[model samples]
Target: MIHPTVVSMVAAIRRRANEYMLRQLSDLGLEGLGPSHAGILGRLFQNGDMAMAEIAAAIRRDKSTVTTLVRKLEALGYVSRRKAPGDARKTLISLTPKGRALRPAYERISRELTELALEGFSSEERKALMGLLGRVRANLSLR
Candidate 1:
């Protein structure tokens, strides 16, 4: 059973974690991106191509915001958008080679940031924290 206090504390911690992570990313030359944009990029990097609406749903954002972000990425040459061959009204989005090239750098910076955040945590503690985070995500996803 989850206590209300525990839930509240967890939520606060999550916010703090987000702030800290974003600050670290800022140090790594990550700029001009809000949380939503970062979320979209991460999703695209992990899941490959997707429809605009699908990307919006996956990122828990609205379609208009996703469209703007997609346009920005497209202009930056990081992504490309095309009408799906079978469906003219539906657009498919995919990361370009330049975007794929960013994966290694992003991964490295993220790993370094995570390591810094967990500097004092033991290996077992880090594993336990990761497992708990995964379970929390799974629980939220089911809803």
Candidate 2:
């Protein structure tokens, strides 16, 4: 049977996955970026512009952390922040053309990461794995 430490296994996987992602990004000449930025960029790519709070919620990060990530992306010219047209208080974040250009590479990396993570899994096994992981995530998010 498998070990009883699911949390430890999950943490180890996350660390290794982030390390793999950082290596890939470094090879692509994205030196300063980290896996944390992926959540923001991916959300923007899928949902278009979003406010800071929305981004934080989407990424499951706190507002302050999201702000810092956004600032780094802004400095790198991957994203831009502007005031919401309707409410000047809300800052809307959107991808620059440079950010959009990363779509293909990130897509490939995401696919390759999944493939590596599920190297031995069959289609049904992959589906079951995803379902289980989703439930795990839900359980954690309920805290």
Candidate 3:
């Protein structure tokens, strides 16, 4: 039996995951909330308020992309920005009440996404897969 190519399989999985997340978000009436936005939201949910540059770094996105994402979130009433204390040049981002209200749905979506991605895998297999994926990511990160 021929083995599937790693790059192709990873790409396909990423595409499917993004599509699934988009559908889930749409079903929850969150139109226009894409994966990049989700990443920012997830970070804010876990880490509370953070500076714009910090959020960008945490989400592994560039400042320009984070700027756009933050603007969209702000427009949706999901997040707000404030000037950092003692640092006029720095802007901090935090979830508004409306955004905090999304925690339950986000948790549910996260659980569903994990189950969907790992369906039929035993606990040991899941652990192994996670380790292997982490190693692959580390390998790719090397210059």
lDDT of 2 by residue, 120-139 (tens): 99999999989999999899
Root-mean-square deviation (CA) per prediction:
4.1, 1.8, 1.5
Write down the TM-score for model 1: 0.66
Residues 1-143, candidate 1, lDDT per residue (tens digit)? 95576468788876876776677557766665444466777888999988999999998889998999988888877889999999999999998998788687667756776777799999999999899978987897899
Candidate 1 ranges with C-alpha deviation above 4 Å? 1-35, 131-143
Error of 1 at 136 (Å): 6.3
Q: For model 3, where is the 10-residue window of minimal lDDT?
A: 31-40
As a whole number from 0 to 100, the lDDT of residue 24 in candidate 1 is 58
lDDT, candidates in the order shown: 0.80, 0.94, 0.92
Q: How accurate is candidate 3 locally (lDDT)?
A: 0.92
In model 3, what lDDT does residue 22 have?
91
Top of the candidates by TM-score: 3
Error of 3 at 94 (Å): 0.9
lDDT digits (tens) for residues 1-143 of candidate 3: 98888878999998998899899999999987887788899999999999999988987899999999999999999999999999999999999999999999888988999999999999999999999999988888895
Shift in Å, residue 98, candidate 2: 1.1
Q: Choose 1 or 3, whichever is better by lDDT.
A: 3
TM-scores of the candidates are: 0.66, 0.93, 0.94
Candidate 2 regions off by >4 Å? 1-4
